[model samples]
Every structure is written in C-alpha cells, then in structure tokens.
Target chain A: MKDVILGIDIGGTNTKFGFLDRDGISLVQGELSTNEGETVHDFLRVLYQEVMTKFKKIEDEANLIGVGVGAPNGNYYTGTIENAPNLKWHGSVPLVDLLKQYFKMPVFLTNDANAAAIGEMVYGGAKNMNNFVVITLGTGLGSGIVVNGQLVYGHDGNAGEIGHTLVNVNGRGRMCGCGRKGCLETYVSATGIKRTVYKLLADSTDYSELRSVSFNDLTAEMITQAAKRGDKIAIDAFEYTGKVLGMKLADTVAHLSPEAIFLFGGLVRAEEFLFDPVRYHMEKNLLHIFKGKVKILPSGLGLNNTAVMGAAALAWNEMERGATA
Target chain B: MKDVILGIDIGGTNTKFGFLDRDGISLVQGELSTNEGETVHDFLRVLYQEVMTKFKKIEDEANLIGVGVGAPNGNYYTGTIENAPNLKWHGSVPLVDLLKQYFKMPVFLTNDANAAAIGEMVYGGAKNMNNFVVITLGTGLGSGIVVNGQLVYGHDGNAGEIGHTLVNVNGRGRMCGCGRKGCLETYVSATGIKRTVYKLLADSTDYSELRSVSFNDLTAEMITQAAKRGDKIAIDAFEYTGKVLGMKLADTVAHLSPEAIFLFGGLVRAEEFLFDPVRYHMEKNLLHIFKGKVKILPSGLGLNNTAVMGAAALAWNEMERGATA
Candidate 1:
C-alpha cells in the first residue's frame, strides 16, 4: 500500500483536512465548521468522526503514516495550542494529545504561518532557497521567517511576529488588537486597508463605490473590484496600504537579507494593484546594498492545499532530521 | 609542536598582527603603521618584514597552521579587499594571494564586523547562541548578522549592511557616503553623534563644553566624558542617538528574532549613557510578544585584544569547517 499522511489546517472559522501522499500530492480534501459549539472538545469529537469515516474508505488503498496540524498559536515544542485570539478556545488545548487517539503515529504541530513557510520550502516557490520570509496578509498580517533552511522558533515558539513591528512612530496611532500601537498589521492587513479607506473618506470628499459601505460591510474583494475599474479613491487606498507595507518590508530586508520574501493569503490576490506599489516603495526605501537584489514573489500553492502540505512537510522534515542524526 | 595561527587586523591607518593558539590565547601582539605614501606592493613588503620577524622568534615554539586577516571591505568569497573607502588602495587587493608568499597553509579574509561576530561565537558572549547580530559602532555603523549558527554572505558577499537602512524618510535628509539620503548610519554613528551635538548647540543657548569645539575637533570620547558629568546637551545627544537606534532595532528584531544583539567598537564605550536609553526605547517599541525577551549586551571581549582575537576565530572556524567538510 502507498504511504499517506493526514494534514490538518485549523482555523477559527473552519478546519480543513487532507490526505497527502509521499510525493506532496493530495488525494482527498474536506472541511468542517469550527467554533460553532460551546467547547473545543465538542468540535474535536465531530472532527474525529468525519476523519475516521474518510480514512476507513482509503485504508484499503493507502497505508497511514502520521498526522500533522497547522493552527493559530500551535506550539512545535509543546504540542499544544495556547490561547489564540479570536478563537473560542481559552486555555492551552492539548491538540496533539487529542489527535493521538485518532491516529497512533508520530504527530507534529506548528503555527499556521510557519506551516505555510514549510509548504513553500517543500513544494512551492521557496524550494530552492535556504533562507526566505513568508508574509500572509489576510484579516490580520502573519509571517514565518526561514533562516539557514529551518524555521526559527525562539525561546517560546513565538519568533515570527513580523506583523507587530511599528512602522509609524507618530503617524496616526492605530491600536493593534495585539495591544500595540502603529504596528505593520495596523496599516497592511485587509482590516488596515478598510481603516485607510474610511479615514480617507472622512478626510476628503472623494466619491467612490465604497463610500456607502459600513465598516462591517466593507470587504477586500469590493475594494479590489472598484480599484480595477479606475476608481480614484479605491486606487489611493491600495497605494497607501502598499506604501506602509513596503516601508516595513525595507526594514525587514535590512535585517534578514533573505534571498526572497513570499506573500500569501487573500489580500495578496489584489495582484498588480497592491504588488506594484509595494515593490516600488520597497525598492525606493531599501539600502543601496540590498536594492535590486531580493525578490518579492507570491506563493505558488493554492490556499486550500498549502496548509495541509506544510503540515505534512513538517513531519517529513522531522523524519529526515531523525534519520540524519 | 603546538598549532598556532597568525591573526591580522588591517585598519586604514594601522595594521595589527598577533600570534594565537587554538584556545584564543595571544602569544605576542604588535602594530605597524600603514604609510599612505607607499604603493600597495611597498606596504606589503613592510607588513611581511614585521610578520617574518615575529614568526622567526616563535618558529621553534609553535607550528604555524594558517593566517586570517580582517579588513574594511574584505570579502570571504573572493579573499580580497575591494575598494576600501578610507584606504588609499583604489581597487581589489587580493589579500590571500599576497599572504600566500609567506604562509603555505590556509589564508582567509572577511570584513571586520564579521570577524567580531566570529569572535563572539568562538570565545565571547555568544558562545551558546546560534542566532545573533553584532553591531560595530565606530566611525560609522557596521553590522554582522548570524542566522542559525552560520554567517550570512549575500550574493555579492556583502550582506549585513544594516546601517545603510533608512530610519527617517522625511526628517533630516543627510547624504550618506554610500550616495543615499537619511540612512541609519548618518544618524547613529560617531559622526552622527557629533552632528547631533552641533544641532543641539545651535538650537539651545545652554552652556556646554561642546559649544567651543569645532566639528573637526570634536571626538566621541569627549562627548562621553561630558555626558558622564551631567552636561545636559551632551546627555541629550546620546538620548537622541539611542532613540533612533532603539526604534531601528525594534524593526530589526521583528525580522530575524535573534537571541541577542552585541555592540562593539569605540562608540560603545559610552555604555550606560547610550545603553540605558537604547534599552528603554527598544522595550517600549517592541511587540508585546518580544518585549523583555531579547537582550542588548556589550561585547565581552576587550577592545585592545578584540581585533586579533576575532581574526584568530575566523581562522579557527575556517580550519574546523575544512576538517568537517
């Protein structure tokens, strides 16, 4: 039987699962609603039932190898999911312990951003790079830094927190949900783009399709659509967001000197509208020594497949390391 | 016979040489003036004479294993010093090729900042760490970043040029020597401190020992002495410098997440006057996830012996790597 591994991507809203083979191919994929019930245990029970049913059907054709998980606040060192913001789970959840009961094999877990970095390294754009950084711009900004061909997990597995670096010391102090002021995420995320649009609308009399949308009603897709149609206000909002992000990226490049920086997540889909401005400002702000050298590219893996592939890559990396040792 | 390495520190004005054992113990150290009137070939003749005298004296006591030289624009990949700004040498000086006439064994060359990083890794404070950054605050700011226990040499072997990163986009637009405007080095170096002192003097009519000193006459040591004696303007100069450095460091930490940052060079002698303010602002600007976690520490190695020790460490590292490979 061919060897297969279980890959899981745990989100606050939904949990995605896939059966991945040795060659980085996914045979089946499924998803379930998360945080719908009162407790994490309730969600786990239903998730296990669905996974078991799926696995049994494939057991005749594939041999189960192990399980890997990617989630918010997942700790590679401790195998637990700590108190992640926006999620109903309050305390440390022993995810590896719970998953062990379902599959009796080696299990690995890491933060979602880190998992994405591993995915890029193993099967996507960063396959040839030994050092690179991955930035995920969604509802919030997330990052995973790869140094010397390995993920950097500091003392408490909280090393990759690039989103929280302050870009503007005195300009429009927006409080990040992380309790920080003027963080990169405060000006670069989808939430940040909406904030910029609202601020621009309030300050100027610029007419646009987005002027009617409420704060809760505004979405990144709408802004991208309007910008594509030559909406001045929408275009300005993306430019403003990209400038802040590019400046922050310049500072990051000075420190890491990575071969490349990979962008992932939903907001990156805006493509040229966001990337052109970001690239221009990043090069403009970069030091002469690093200018025109570092490549900033989008992740090649699809959203649904990347997380699962990354989780599986973590197990594969561990296995390789163990074999070498 | 005991294994010994020749350590050479090539400064723009003077070249220091020392004989060291594997344990980093210096047997003998001396300095030679690099006469500006002499051509590159003439200067090497003088350097070789001094090296021969020292080697002859110790030839019976130790076995000469290798030679390592650290200089301003040294490139490890090419083993050459390329267009060092302060030195009269105008083009690529193949240092390893020159050294081969005297020693037949391995000869290595790297930039001074990288040498200092190797110093910390082999015999100083960073012995236990695999990830850290070393900042040399001398005439100008120079840095060496180590990620995952290896030195990062970019495509052109000119990585770790953090000082050239722009800290202020629209503030004082001072032209950097690198043909850039408002670089971090333009505001954080010894020259930067003097500029700040002059700016402070012009802004305030306060009594200061610094007021009478001309820009060409002022020195970093004098500024430190005045700040230690409660000179308000002098104290403020250091605080201003530290604030810029701290904010820039916060941005750096967000990218690499190094375990610690090591400071070296003559300017770092200000110690508390500079460190206190740097520490305060760094902690203040850091993300909550990294606050109070990373450390800012002074170089444990003595200034008088650091150059030779650092060069010696480079030789040791090269030898070890060769053996392992």
Candidate 2:
C-alpha cells in the first residue's frame, strides 16, 4: 500500500481535506461545512465520521501515516486555535488533540499562512531558499516568516501577525476587526481594496464604473473588473492598496531581509494591478543594501489546492524532523 | 592549563580584546587604537603582536582555543567587514581569513550587535530564552534578532537592519548617513537624541541648559544630565526619542514577536529618562495579543566589557555547534 498523509485546511465557511503522498501528489480530496455542528466536539465528531468513511474506501490502496492541519489562528506549539475571529469556535480550540482522538498517528498544526510557507519550502520555489516570507492576502492579510529553514513561532506561537501592525499611528484611519484602528490589513486585503474603492469614489469627481456599486454589495472581483475597463477609481484603489502594502513590506524587509516575498490568496488574482505598485514603492523605499535584492513574486503553489498541499507539506516536514531526531 | 577564547571588539576609535573561559569569566583584557595603522593588514599585525605579548605572559596558566571578532558591518556568512562607514577600512576585509592566518584555531566574525545577542543568550539574563532581540543604541541603532536559539543571519547574512526602516514615509525628515531620510535610527540613537534636543530647542522658546550648546559640542550625556535637572528641551527630547523608538519597536514586535527586547550601548545609560516613555508608548501601540507579553529590559551584560564578552560568546557558541556537528 502507498503511504499517505492527511491534510486538512479549515476555513470559516468550508473545510477542505485531502490525502497526499510524500511527493505532495494528492490521492483523495473532499470538503464539508465548518459551521455544520454547534460545538467544536460536535464538529470534530462529524469530521471524524466523514474522514473514516473516506479512509475505508482508500484503505486497500493507500496507508495513512499521519495528519496535518492548517486553520485560522492555529498555533504550532500549543496545537490549538486561539481566538480566531472568522471561526465559529469561541476560545482556544485544541484542534490537534481533538484530531488525535480519531487519527492514530502523529498530528501537526499551524496557521494556514505558515503552512503555505512550509509548502513553499518543501515543494515549491523556496525548496532551495533558506529564508523567505509568504504573505496570504485573502479577506485579511496573513504572513509567515522563515529564517534558517525554520518557521518562527516566537515565544507565544503567534509571531506572524503582520496584519495587526499599525498603518496610521495618529489618525482614526480604518477600524480593524481586532478592535484596533489603522491596521495594515485594513488597507491591504481583499476587503481593504473594496473599502479603498469606496473611499476613492467619495474623494474624486472623476467618473468610474465603481461609482454605482454600494459598499455592502461591492466585491474585490468587481473592482478588478472595473480596473480592467480603465475605471479611474478602481485603478486608484489598487494603487493605494499596493502603496500601503509596499511601504509596510519595506519595513518587513528591513527586519527579515528574506530572499523573496511570496504573495498568495484571492487578492493576488488582481495580478499586476497589485504587484506593480507594490514592487515600485517597495524598491523606492527600501534601504540601499536591500534594493534590487529581495524578490516580490507570485506564490509557486497552484491556486486550486494550495492550502491542502501546504497542510500536507507541514506533515511531511514534521515526519522528516522526527526521523532525523 | 585553562582553555579560553580570545574575544576582540573593533570600534571606530578603539579595539578591545579579552580572554574568557567557557564560563564567560574574563582572564585578561587590553585595548589599542583602531586608527593607529595605515591599512587593515597593519592593524592586524599590531593586534597580533599585542595578543602575542599578552599570551606570552599567561602561557603556562591558560590556553587560547579560538578567536571571535565583532566589528561594524561584519557578515557572519562571508566572514568579512563590508564597507564599514565608521571604520578606516574602505572595502570588504576578509577578517576571518586574516585572523585564521595568525591564530592556529577556528575564528568567527559577525556584526557587534549580533555578538551582543549571542552574549545575552549564553551569559546574560536571556540565558533561557530561545527567541529575543538586542537593540544597540550607540551613535546609530543596530539590532540582532534571534529565533529558535539561532541568530537570524538572513539569506545575505545581514538580516537585522531595523535601524534603516523608515520612520517618516513623506516630508523631508532627518537625513541619515545611509543616504536615506527619516530612518528609525535617525530618531532613536545617541546622536538621534542629541539631534532631537537640537530640534526641541529650535521648535520651543522655553529656556533650557541645551540652548547654549552647539551641535558639534552636544553629547547624549549632556542631554541626560539636563533632563535630570528638569531642562524642558532635554526632557522633551528624551520623551520624543522614546516615543519614536517605542513606535518602531511595536512594528519590530509584529515581525519577530521576540520574548524580550534588550536595550544596549551608550544611550541606555539614560535609564528611566528613556525606559519610562518607551515602555508607555510601546504598550500603547502593541497589538492586543502581544500586549503585556514582550519585555523591554536593559542588557544584562556589564557596560565595562559587554562587547568583549559578546565576542567571546560567539566563539563559545560556534565551538559548541562544531562539537555537535
């Protein structure tokens, strides 16, 4: 039987899972509603039933070796998901411990962004890179910093919180869901771009496709489409978003000096609209030594199943470490 | 004979050297003028001669096992001092290779701030800490970030350049030696504090002891003394400096999330005149999860020979790594 590891990516809406071999080749894939059950235990029970049903069908073909999970606010050190705003769970959820109750193998967990970083290292462009950063620009901005080939969990297992860093120290810029004002995520994420488009519409008298769209109904894709049609306000929104992201990225580069920075997630679909200004402003603001050195590139992982692959890579990395240790 | 490590700290003005046992106890210490020699080779030759004379006196009692050197712009990976602005050396000097020729033992070279971080890990208050940061606030601000018990040398061996991170993204701010404007170092270092005093003097009309001091004659100590005596401009300078430092530190915390940030070097002597405001503003700006968690503490290494101890710690750390490898 072929050895396989189970990889699970938990989200606020849907939960995706897949089984992969050591090579990161997928064997089976599936999904379920994260909001299905009332409690975490109830949710795990449903998840266990679904996994067992799937495992039985593949048991004769592939032998499950271990499991890895990527979720919002997942802590690699504690194996818990703490205070994740998007999830239905209330407090710190012992994800690893709960998963262990159903799976008779070693289990590992980290935030999705960190999992993506490990995926980059183990199977993607960063396979040869010892240090790099992976930024997930979804509805919110998330980051994972790698140095010396190891993920920095910090002292509290929650080190990669770049989204929470302030953008405007003095102004009441934007209200962050974290109950703070002017967070970097407030101006850089997919939601942030929508927010930007609305602000631009209000600020300028120039005609644009976005003028008719209401904030509650508008989406990032609408803005992207408008920008493609040469909508001035939409284009300005992307520019402003990139400018903010680039300035913060310059600060990030000063601290980590990573070989490259990988941009991943839905907002990355905007492509040049986002990358161009980010690259320009980042270079314009970079310290002399770091200039023309750090690469800002698209994620190497295929967009379709990147999160699942990342979770699998985390499992593989841990197994390799266990073998070596 | 007791085995010892020869530690050397190269400064713009003086080069200090010391012999330290594995326990970090100093056996012998001496210094020589850094500007005495015409070339780097001449400087090394004199340093070697001075080291030999000192070694000859202790030959029967102690044995030198290895050497560690800390200098401005030192690169751990390249083992070179690359275009140190403060040093007389004009190019990348292969310091480790040069030292290896004279010392028949292993040698290592890294920036002084990194050495100080290793010193904190091996011998100071952070002995148990696996993740921490050391900020050197001398004429310029320098930082060394540690994660998972290893210093973050980055891909280029120059990861920690927190000082160069921008403070003011717009408006012509303080000019930096790095050809950048509004860098964090321009507002937080010893010279930064002095500059702040001058700016305060210019911005405010209140009478103060610093009003008479010229820019060339102003020192950080004079500012501290004046602040102690309740000089308005001097006190304001310290407060402004702390606010700037604390704000930048909050950003630093977002990236690394180190257990503690240790303040070192000349400006640290200001004590509460600096620490109080830094603590206040850092807390005020820290992200919710990180608040009340990261400690901002004074360096545990004694001011008299901190650099020497740091360099020696680097040698010891490398030796231990070599043994394990």
Candidate 3:
C-alpha cells in the first residue's frame, strides 16, 4: 500500500480532516461540526468515525502511517490544547492522546499558526527558506516565526503569540478577549477594524456608508466592499490597520531578521489595498540595513483548506525528521 | 595533535585574540591596537604576527584547528565587517579573507552580539537552552537571538538589531548614533543614560553632584555613586532606564518567547539597580500567558574575557557542525 498521513484541523466551528499521500495528494476528505456545547470526547469520537469512513474507500490503495493535528492552542511538546477561547471545551484538552488510542499511529501537534508556518516551509513560498514569518489575519491575528529553518517553539509550547502583544503600551481603554489593552489583534485583526470604524464614526463628522451600520451588524466583508467602492472611512481604516501591522512587523524583523514575511487569510483578499500599505510602512520603519531587503508576499495556500494543508505538512516534516534521524 | 580554536574580538580601539583547547582552556592570549587611521592591511599584518608569536608556546601542545572572529557588523555568510561606524574604517573590509591567507585554516565570523550569544549557549548559562537572547549592555545595546540552538543570521546576516527598534513612535527628539529617533539604544545604553542625566538636570532643579560635572566628565560610575549617596536624580535615571529596557524586553518576549534573557556588559554591573526594575516591569508588561515564564538573568560570563569565549564558541560550534554534517 502507498504511505499516507492523516491531517486534522480542529477549528471551533468545524473540524476538517483528510488523508495526504507522501506526494501531497488528498486521497480522502471529510468534515464534522465541533458541537460547541458538547464534550470534546464526543466531538473527537464522531470526527474519528467520519474520517475513517472516508478513509475506508482508499484503504486498499493507501496506508495511514501517522497523524498530524492543528488546533488553537495545540502544544507540540505536550500534544494538548490549552485555554483555546473559541473552542467548546474548557481548560486543557488531551485530544492527541485520545486520538492516538483510536488510530494507533504516531501523532504530532502544534498551534494553528505554527502549523501554517510548517505548511509554508513544506509546500509554499518558503520551500527553500531557512528564516521567514507567516502572519495569518482572520477573526484574530496569528503569527508563526521560523528561524534557521526551525520553528521557534520557545521554552514553553506557546511561543508565537504576537497577536496579544501590545501595540499601544498606554492605549486608551481598548481591551482584548485575552484581557490585555492595546493588543495588536485589537488594532489589526478583522474584529479590530470594526472597532476602529465605530471609533471613527464617534470622532469624525465625515459622511461614510459605515456610519449607517450598527457595531454588531458590521463585518470585515462590508468594510472590504466599502473600501473597494472608495468610501473614505473604509479606506482610512485599512490604511490605519496596515500601519499598525507594518510597525509590528518591523519589530519582528529587528528581533528575528527573517528573509520574508507571508501574509495569509481573509484580509489578504484586499490585495493592494492592504499589501501596498504594509510594504510602504514596513520598509519605511525597517532598520537601514534591512531596508528593501525583506519581502512581504502573499500566502501561496490562499483560502482553500490551509489548516488541513498545514496539518499535513506538520506530519510530513515530523515523519521525514524521524526517518533522517 | 590536540585540537583547538583561535578566538578573536576586533574592537574599535583594541583587538583581543586567544586560543582555546577542546577542554575550554584559554591556552594563549594576545592584544594589539586596531590603528584606525592606517589601512586594514597594515593592522592585519601586525595583528597576525602578534597572534602567531603568542601561539608559538602552545603550538607543540595544541594544533590550531580553526579561527572564530567577533567584530562590529561582522557577517557570518560572507565573513566580512561591513560599514561599522564605531571603527575608523568607513566601508566594508574583507577581514576574513585577509586573515585566512595568514592562518590557512577554516575561519568563521559573526557580529559581537551573536558571538556573545554563542558564548552563552556553549560556555555559559544557556548551554542547556535551545532558545534564549543575549543582550550586551555596553557602548550601545547589542543583542543576539538564539532559537532552536542556532544563531539567527537572517537574510543578510544582520538579524538581531533589537537596539534600533523604536521605543517611542512619537517620541520627543531622542536621536541615536544610528541616525534614527526614539531608538531603544538612545534611551537604554550607557551613553543613553548619560544623556538622560543631562536631560534630567535641564528639566529639574533638584541639586545634585551631576550638575557640577561636565558632559565629558560625567560617568555612569559617578551616577551610581551618587545614587548610593541618596541622590534623587541618579536614582531616577536608573529607574527610567530599567523601565525602558523592561518595556522593550516585554516586546521581545511577545515576539521571540525565549526561555531567558541574559544581560551582559557595563550597565548590568549596576545589578539590582537595573535588575529589579527590569524584572518588575517586564513581568507587568508581559502577556498573561508569559507573565512569569520568562527570566531575565545576569550574564554568567560577565567581563572576564566573554568576547574571547564567545568567538571561541562560534568557531567550536562551526567545527563541530562541519564534522557532524
């Protein structure tokens, strides 16, 4: 039988799983609701069954060799997800141990952002790069830093929490779910721009379509559409968001000195609306030696099953490392 | 023959060179003036001759295996010193190639901070650590970031320039030697604190011994002595310095998430004056998950030939990697 690995992305709303061959073919794929209020055990049990049912069709052609997982707070060292806010489960979830018992295969796990970073290295723009960063912009901002071709897991399993880092040390009253003020996520994420929209409406008399929308009704998509239509408020919001992100990226450059930074997820769909500002401000803020040297590029994975691809890459990397060792 | 590495530290004023056996002994040592006004050729010729003379005694006991160099703006990828303002040399100098002709052995070079980082990992507190940062608090704040047991060289071999990162986005006129305003070095270095003393004197009327001293005459030592004598301005200077350093370190933690940070050079000698504030503020500013996790420690090597030890470690690490590969 051909060797294949199982890739799982444990998202809050839905869980996606697929079997990826060594050549990167998705032999089989399946999905199941996470069931927000249900026990993690119940969810995993259902997910396992669903995934296996799909895997059965290709059983004769492919052998599932190992499992790779990506979750909100997945820890590679402990193989647990701890305090992931969006997930249904409270406290730490030992999903890896539970899955290993059912699958009887080698298992590995890491945070969602780190999974994306490994994905970039294994199957994306950073294939030959030894140092780069992957910044994923979604409901919240997430970052994965790779130095010398190795993921920076830090002393703790939780190393890449750039989203929660403060942009305004003495910020005026903006708080995050992480209970911090002036977090980068508060200023740069999808949720952040909505908040910026409300703040702009309150402070300015400028007429804009966003002023008609309620805070709860407003979505990142609406803002993108408005910006595309040349609404002044929407345009300004994107510019401000990119400014904060570029400044933080400049800090990342100073600290890690990566060859490039990859921008992924929803906001990247804005294309030049976001990329132009990020490049201009980042280069403006970069140290003289690093000026015009680092590239800020689009994520090659796009929006299609990045989490699943990331998980698969993680598994492939670990399996390859094990064999080489 | 017993294998040993030669370590060299090229400073603007003085250059230190020493040989180390595999057992970590400083077998032989020598020094020479860099003589900035003269051509690099003349300086290297005299320096190589002086180093060779010192190596003569140990030549019988230990075989010269390799050479490691630490200098301002030293690039490991190209093994050159490029555009270091502190040195009288105005442009890039191919120091490694010039030295290689004299020694005819493998040579490696990296910036002073990176050398210090390797020294910490190979010979100091971080020997067991795979991720840590070394900040040398001397003439200007210099940093070396180590992730996954490897030094980050970035795209251009200039990854860890943390000193140049801006502390104040809209900071009031604090220009650095690097020609940037609000640079962390402008507020955290020895020269920075001296400048702070002058600023404090200009802003406050509190009578202190510093008012009696000229800018050229005033020193960090005198300030420390004054603080010991209950001088308010001197005490405030240390506090303000630590606050800036700690706040910046909090940002460092958010970005890299290293196990610990090692502080080296002159200002670290102040000990509690710097440590207490750094610890207090670093923990306060850190994200909830990393609040008490990261440690700020004094450099284990201190002033006892750390530069030599660091350069030696770089050479030894390279030699070992070459052997294993």
Candidate 4:
C-alpha cells in the first residue's frame, strides 16, 4: 500500500489540492472555485466532497498520513485562520477542528508565504541553506523568512512581513493596502510597478509604447514586452523598481543577514531585466563586510504547483517534528 | 578553591577586568587605560601585569576556568579584532593568541553588542527568552539579534549592523560616519541626536534652552534635561528619533518576530522620555498582529559594569557549549 499526503492551497479566488507521496510526486491534482462569500462550513463541505470523490479509487491502496493547508493569515501555533481580508471569514476560524472531522489525521496549517518558504527549503533551491528569505512579488509583496533552518513565526505568528517595511519614507504617496505609506510593497509589487510607470511617464517626456495605456490598464506583461523591445521608459521603470527593492534588501541584510533572498511570483518571471538591477543596487548599497555574499535566486518550483507542494511540505515538517519527539 | 571566570571589556579608552562565578557575582574588578597606540605586545604586557598584580592576593584561592574579552569589532568565529574604527588598530589583531600566552585557559571573544546580548540572556532581562534583539544606542546603533536561542552571525561575523539601515531616505542630507546617507545611526544615536538638534536649530523657529548650546557642546543629556523641563523642541527631537526608530523596528519585528527588544546605552537612560515615545510610535507603526504582543524593555544591567559582565557571559556561553559538545 502507498502512503499519501493531502496538500491544500487556499486562495481568495480558487483553491488547489493535490495528493502527493514522500518524494513530492503528485498522483492527482485538482482545483475548485472558492466561493468565499458562502459560509465557512458550506465551503468546507463542498471541498471535502470533491476531495473524497477524487480519491475514492485509491482510498484502499493509499493510506492517508496527514493534511497540510496554506491559507492567508493562517497561524501555525493556533491552527486558526485569523481575519483574512480577502476571505469572507470575519474572525479566527478553527481550521484544525473542521479538518479533523474530515481527515482523522495529523493536520498542519501556516500562512501561504511561510508554506512557500518551507517548500523552497524541502524541494526547491533553498535545500542546503540555513537562512534565506522567499519574496513573492504579486499584486502585493509577501515574504517568508527562514532563519537557522526554521521559519521565523515570532511570538504571534506575524513574522516575515518584509513587504510592509518602509523603503522610502517620503518618495511616494501611494498608500499600501495595509494602511502604510511608502512601504516596499508600494513600489515593488505589480500594482507598485504600475504606479511607477505612471510616475515615470509624468516625470519624463519619453513616448513610444505604454503612453496610450491608462494607469489602470498598465500590466506587468505590457511593461515586460515594452522593455524587451528596448523601450527606455519601460527599462527605467524596472530599474527604478529593482533599485528600491535592492536598497530595502540591504537594510534587511544588515538586520538578519540571510544567505539568500529567493524571488517568486509573476514579477520574478522578468528574470534578468528585474534581477540584474536588484543585484547591482543591492551590492552597491551593502556594507563592506557583507559584500560579495548573499545570493538572490529565483524560485525553483513552478508557479502553478509550488503552493500545493509547499502546503504538503508543511505537513511533512510537522510529521517529522512529531516523530523526533 | 572557588572557580571564577575572568571577564575583560576592552574599550578604545579603557579596559575593565572582573572575576565572576556561576552565580553572576563579581569577585574582583579593576580597570586600566588601553593604550592602543602601542604595539600589541606592549598592550598585552601591561594588561597581564595589571591583572597579576591586582589579583595576586587571592590568585591561588580562585581557579580561573576561562577568559572572555569584548571589544568594538571582535569576531566570535575568529578570536580577533578587525579594524575597529574607534581604536587606532589597523588590521586583524589576534586577541586570543596574545591572551593565551598569559593564561593557559579557554578564551572567547565577540563584539560589544553580541556580548551584551549574551549578558542579557545569561544574567539580565532576557534570561528566559529564546528570541530577542538588544539595541545599543551609543556612538552608533549597534544591534544583536537572537533567534531560537542562538546569535545570528551571517556569512561573515558582521550580521547585526542595524545602525546602517536607512531610516530617512529624504529627511536630511547628513552623511553617516559609515559613508552612507540617512542611516538610522544618523538620527538615533547620541551623535545622531546632536545632528538632529543642529538641523532643528537651522530649520525651525522653535526656541528653547538648547539654542544657547554650541554644536560641539550639544549632547543627548542636555536634550533629555530640556525635555524634562517641558521644552517643545527637545521633546520633538525625541519624538522624531522615536518615530524613525519605531518605524524601523516595525520592519524588524516583521523579520525576526522576537519576544522583546532590549534597549541600552546613554540615550536609553532618558527612560520615559525615550521609551514612552518609542513604545507609542512602535505600536502605531507595527502590523496589527504584533501591535501589543512584543515588548520594548530597558536594560536591567548597570551601565558602569555591564561591559565586563557581558564579556564574561560570552566566555560562559562558549564554556557551556564546549561542555555540551
């Protein structure tokens, strides 16, 4: 009989699930639209039914070991999802209790970014690293810090909010969704890049591509395309974004001194265009003592499957901890 | 015979030596001028001569287990002092090699900030904490980060350079002694606060008792006194410094998520004048998850003797590690 673990990645729009073995090979992958407007109980019922039906053929052959879940605002210590802004859930939801009724197995839950970090540690580029940071550059910047071979959850499971760190105190007036001003997320995220484009357009008289595109319609893909075609304005925007990220990274390095910072998500797909500038500026800003160290690498796991793998890795980590004890 | 550990705190101006038992008691304490301008051999000769003469009466009665030295830029990984800017030293000075000639015992060395953190962990406020940050707001804003009960030393032994972290990107053009602009040390340290007062005098019409003091004569002590006397400008200076510190601390909290941050140095002696504003602004700037959970505590160690005690504790930590290994 084969033993399998259930990995669940919960998002605001959709939820992804996978059945995996010890080697991280997925036997079955599935997704379902997350009707966050519905009650938590109703959403769970539908999810459970779908999962049970999908695994019915292999239920007898495969022994289920545990379940791991990655969700927004998930607290590893309390096993609850706190007031997640994107979800309909208003307060702390006891996810462990709800999952226990369905799985009758050991379950683990952590914030999505942290799960991604664990994934990187177990199955990705950070396999040999003792200290590193995983940065997800999406609509907002999300970070997961790994210190001394373990994720830093702090006393209240609120560690690794590096995106909210102030990069510029008075450079921009764009308010972060977190109610903070001039945060790193305000200048480096996908939304932040668009704002940068608008600012650059306003500051420079360059015209070629993206001049006609409204600020609301500007996307990261368009910017990448423009840069590939050698648009100086687009190139400048990327350079500006990377410069801000690098300077902020220098400050982070001064504090924690991680071995590397792993870039993930859509913005990272630009690769050399974004990474070269980030690395160049970071090295320039770094202190003499910390020079020529700390690599900035891209996430090894594919974007579609990384979250699910990370979620599964969380369960595996807990299972190993239980065995060690 | 009672067992004692010799603790040595090496400063640019003076060197303090003390003998401590496991119970955190100081048996004998002495001080000597560090004449760093002299050759390394001469400096050690004087240090050893003083130690032998001072403790000769009870030398045979007490068994010395080890020696610990703390200096401006001491490295734990390699028992050497690397080009401390405050001292007249030029290159890497192997302090352990010189000390070993005098005493055939175990010796450990670390920078002053790391030594203080170990002191707090072993004998002071952070005795029970597995994670914490000790900030020394002296000539510079030195920081020591403890994660999961161990000090975080990066690729090089220069991990905790929190002073170099930029706090104000555009607030002022004051260049840091580190050759950087707007570093946290440029606004929070004793030197930093003086710079702030000077800037305030030049920019603002706010008048106080501080106006009469020249830039060379202006000190953090004077600012504290003026704040105590309800001087608005002095109070505003503290407020401004705290605001920058608190905002940066929020980012720090997000990175490591320590249980508390221990503040030390002459500036911290202002107590409520500094701490209240720091606390207020730290809370205001912190993410909701960490708003009231973490603490900002004043150092419990006496300023007069903390340096020696901290250096001793560093030796104690090394001894404990050796014993376990």
Best by TM-score: 2
* Chain A (candidate 1) TM-score to true chain A: 0.95
Residue-wise lDDT of candidate 4 within B1-325, one digit each (tens)? Answer: 8888899999889999998887678888889888843787788888888887877866877888999899998987788999899777679999988899898989888899998998998889998898899999887888888887888876467788898887755335568887767788888898888888778878899878999999899889999888889987888888788877887888788787899999988888777878887898778777667878889998877676898989998888878877321
Q: For residues B90-121, write the lDDT of model 3, one tens digit per residue.
A: 78888889888898888889999999999998
For model 4, residues A71-141, the per-residue Cα lDDT tens digits are: 99899888899999988778999997898888888888998899999989888898888888899888788
Residue A267 lDDT in candidate 3 = 85
Candidate lDDT (C-alpha), each = 0.83, 0.89, 0.86, 0.84
Candidate 2's C-alpha lDDT? 0.89
Ranking by DockQ: 2, 3, 4, 1
TM-score-based ranking: 2, 3, 1, 4
Model 3 is docked with a DockQ of 0.78
In the range B1-325, model 1's lDDT, one tens digit per residue, is 7898899998978989899998788887778886634687788788888888888888888888888889998998788899898888889988888888767889988999999998888888999887788988888898888776787675457777778777766334677887768888888889989989998999999999988899999998899999989899999999998988888888777766778989888778898889988888888888776789889999877677798889988999889888311
Model 4 residue runs over 4 Å out of place are A1-4, A53-63, A170-172, A202-205, A208-218, A321-325, B1-3, B52-63, B97-105, B170-172, B204-214, B229-233, B321-325
Clashing pairs for predicted structure model 4, backbone only = none
| Runs in model 3 lying further than 4 Å from the true structure | A171-173, A323-325, B170-173, B323-325
What digit string (tens of lDDT, one per residue) describes model 2 on residues B139-193?
9999999999999999999889999888887524799999879899999998999
- TM-score (C-alpha) between model 1 and the true structure: 0.94
After superposing candidate 1 on the true structure, give the runs of residues whose Cα lies further than 4 Å from its correct spot.
A36-42, A170-172, A323-325, B35-42, B97-102, B170-172, B323-325
The DockQ-based CAPRI class assigned to model 1 is: medium
Best-to-worst ranking by lDDT: 2, 3, 4, 1
